[model samples]
Target: MTTKRKPELVAYTVTGEGEKAYWTRIGSAWAHKDGEGFNLDLAALPVNGRIVLMQPKPEGDAA
Candidate 1:
């Protein structure tokens, strides 16, 4: 009996000095059942940047 991993939309942004300053959708996140941590399924990790994980924003919550 195996449980499926819940995937959450994760966003990656290039920041800091000497790195590409841009924001884009990088990949999906499979969170653990315990709500402690998760894993990312990225197409390719940016050479220089930062990675941020969060649940997908609601369509009506756009600012």
Candidate 2:
């Protein structure tokens, strides 16, 4: 049996730039067993924004 682990990266829809930039949580990604690709699950797809992948923050830490 296989167990699911927490996502290593968080996906976001980004708009604007610099201090004015906005980030919206859109999905999560899990690396494949072979480490050659990732499995992405998105709640919504953006039409006019860019998708950015970043590491998840530690619990209780906000930046």
Residue 12's lDDT in candidate 2: 94
Model 1: per-residue lDDT, tens digit, 1-63? Answer: 133644665657556545545566677777666989866678768767577666877668862
Candidate 2 C-alpha lDDT tens digits along 1-63 = 133788879899988999998899998998888999988888988888689999999889974
Regions of model 1 farther than 4 Å from truth: 1-6, 16-21, 60-63
lDDT values, one for every candidate: 0.65, 0.86
Where does the lowest 10-residue lDDT sum fall in candidate 2?
A: 1-10
Could you list the CA RMSD of all candidates, in the order they appear? 5.2, 2.8
| lDDT value for model 1 | 0.65
Query: What's each prediction's TM-score?
Result: 0.54, 0.86
